[model samples]
Target: MTKLKGFGFKRYHLILLGFVTLASIATARIVQLHIYQHEFLSEQGDARSVRNIPISAHRGTITDRNGEPLAVSTPVVTLWANPKVLINQKSRWSELAKVLGESEKSLAERIEKNAQREFMYLERSMTPERGQAAQDLRIPGIHVREDFRRYYPAGEVTAHLVGITDIDEQGREGLELAYNEWLAGVPGKRQVLKNLRGDVIRDVQVLQNAKPGQSLALSIDLRLQYLAHRELRNALQEFKAKAGSLVIVDVKTGEILALVNHPTYNPNNRSTYSAEAIRNRALVDVFEPGSTVKPFTIAAALGTGRWQPQSTVDVGNGVMKVGRYTIRDVSRGGVLDLTNVLKKSSNVGVSKIALDIGAEPIYTMMQQVGFSTDTGLGFPGESLGYFPAYRRWGSAEIAAMSYGYGFSITAVQLAHAYAILGNNGQSSQLTFLQQEKQGPSIPIIEPDISHTVMEMLRSVVEDEGGGGVRARVPGYHVAGKSGTAKKQAASGGYTKDSYRSLFAGVGPVSEPRIAVAVVIDEPREGGFYGGVVAAPVFSRVMAGSLRLLNVRPDNLAQQVVKQGQVVRGGRS
Candidate 1:
């Protein structure tokens, strides 16, 4: 009986001993976690407790010289989703799809397809009004992140100049693409503590102040740009033209005042536009500059002492044969002086003078005038327009070139060349920014010769030069030339249905403050001559630009001259 009682006690004691051993092992693990592995466990805890949210950076604003906003940033919300959590939530998706302006099937498919990710963008760039609706709904597992979208306030008016950016806020065209590095700023970050509700209770900044991008101020006057836009658009539509472009520059400063290209795109929402609409036609498109280049040939002759403004050759019968092609004037062959050659736009007259200058010197003169070089306006796909090196020449090249068709040039290039004539023949650079101290430059063409050309240009606006007469403004003397080039087809035939009309000129001829160039491409299935289609547009723009610059009227000069003549008569 004693042994049985002792055995039972021993068995109970062994069981209690086993329980103590298990308790001791558990305490060892607790110590390891609290002491030896404390840091690792703490990091694990923090990983699940803390959250990272990115802070967005806004791109800088682009403004005109007058401080008018051409482009700006507006705060908006973008819808996002955690794909794994959002898929199969039909009701929530249905509501979201309605707000996002998408069908339910697309929303469901987008989420289902991207379920492999924790982060996914459901919709991009929704308007503030619509985003606010999604925000109010507050669907679980859905989020709205703060972001910015760039807006062009002027819309299509300055589209080709300011350019546009893509969905990721990367600049892709014009000044935006050219100065992208300077325009895109550094992004910043922040950290915060939130109670499971994802509501911030304690916020701490993780980075220094976000730097805003530097402002870009262009040389463009908004008013002049608007005026040019209106006139060019109207001309393009009226003439039923395929496309057109215009450029205005300050001769002294070499600053571009206004540049307009038709068939322009709106940068605001560029969803369905072609590359053509986005192209800066003034800088990109090159066309044969017919007849308009004749003056340069004459100017080069005068500069080189090969001829004077009075230099003349009989423009025989108004027709000269060149390689089976007869270069003829708009009129019958007739004898004319230098100014008469310009006024009548006699191809034969200019061709004879070009022959005297010789093709080599003429090409060199045009090259030095900037026609051989690109305007370098920083636009994408800018062309130097081919000017055939002096080494490449033929008999007909000079004759054909004198009246303007053998060489190709962009509208901006024409403006720069005319600018040289206006600036007393010191051809210089062209600038897009008003703050730029640089200018277009070339060797001076004896100021006297330039004055002679200036006076001749005045005759263009007066009664003698009929084409330029239409280009004249009421009070300002204008000097300019006209061009009408036959458009060649891609299939190797000249398109009788097409012509590139052009008007290149200088304004307020007394002081010569503005230089302008306009081109009309394939106008209205009707007569497409630079003088008839483009010069009228130039007249309107020059009038607006001169008015904007407050250039003193020549009317005052006329009064003073008349008064002086009267006093001189009395003194005599």
Candidate 2:
């Protein structure tokens, strides 16, 4: 057939032409997929198989000065699920419940409750191994997220000082809240690959690196902390007191060696938390100092070169009238030297000294010793104990101020004041951070004056009729004062029965090493005197602390040689 021969094709040629047309169409589709639709398809695939996930940064560890762990962060995982997918896997719900320690019904209810939402936490803070076990079950939509749980190794013993963090690992109190920014590290991001089951197959790449928090080294000595906590707790129980606080400080460095509160709560357990139990009383709560301020009044007099340790004041009938306010003392009316004023805890004696010195010198001396201000700790909720201005002082006000009345002072403030006396009038700012070297100290008073005051304080514990007789250690000479202040009634005047017993002291009187303060609030059993309730705590805690710090004894029993035979008498 020659007709249309130019255009006509044989059967084999037609087949070959058909194959070429199909091949061309296939190549175009390949080009569309590899080039034109490449970006869209890649995005879709990544949506299902890749993800940008956040990596949780580890929280910092908090340790005592001796490197003992106080607070620590442990690695854990939070298990979550896509309820839409999980609800479909009803049969696997029991298995999930078994790992979660929940009943099957409970698991079902949880999943159903969150079914509309794509994400819900099945469990938080599960061990890594436990989380992995659940993840390996191959249940669809189950996911594991990295997290941290804070743990306090010292528990209630260090709770007040170390403080606590919330579920999200944010510091909430004490030193934790004060240095949160320094401790909490920045979280980072990373790209990861996943399979169809939502399980991470491999890490694709690190978009950002996670930064771990820095470790905190506190100034507290764990050993001393335990000792103080135990002694304070025991004192609270023995005295049937409402609450108590104790603080130990290094005289030379002003480092708070130990700070404890009787009503402290455990930082590890959230359920044990309460406002009353969690408050750091040593730094936060303030009370009238009572006889604790007597020494300062005497110190002010000594500064004027008008009084000496032997200077005498007549506390006639143990009562003095100042602007219709009667200042009375429990001691017998008599003439007492400056040293006896403290030893007897005579309110009248200190009042006379305060009246003679006027208000400015007493105010200046107290201010220089760190009263009416924060101890520079920057502790959360720290109180600047109220010390009225000298400009406002009347005769009654001055007399009241002399014996620790009409104002307030925190336990730590009282401790800091005593620490200056112990440190030879060198006032160092208090610190919770361990000091590598002695920080700069302000010279608060002349060395001779401080020395005189320290000796006077020593007599309060060492003399035969000293008020702080119970505070004396067997081998160490303790210099301290006792205070029994009346708590002001809510209406106006002070309550007759309610009292705050206090004892503040420094040890190894010859060369001071440590200063400690103890406060027992409202002792109902035994005596409410500071010498009775707080001084014993000081004695036991100071005695043990001195031995632990290897401080040599300054008041050891006198040894005498008699005919080549050694004889030991009572403590010097």
- Point out where model 1 deviates above 4 Å: 1-21, 103-106, 193-204, 436-444, 555-572
Candidate 2 segments whose C-alpha is farther than 4 A from its true place: 1-37, 195-197, 558-572
Residue-level lDDT of model 1, residues 420-492, one tens digit each, is: 8898887666777766465446665667888898787677656533556667676777788877889989998
Q: Which residue pairs overlap in candidate 2's backbone?
A: none
Model 2, position 169, has a per-residue lDDT of: 89
Task: Summing lDDT over every window of 10 consecutive residues in candidate 2, give the lowest-scoring window.
Answer: 563-572
Q: For each predicted model, how many residue pairs clash, with residues at least 3 apart or on different chains?
A: 14, 0
Predicted structure 1: clash tally: 14
Instruction: Give Cα-based local distance difference scores for all models.
Output: 0.79, 0.87
Clashes of 2: 0
User: Residue 548 of candidate 2: its Cα lDDT?
Assistant: 93
Using lDDT, give the best candidate's number: 2
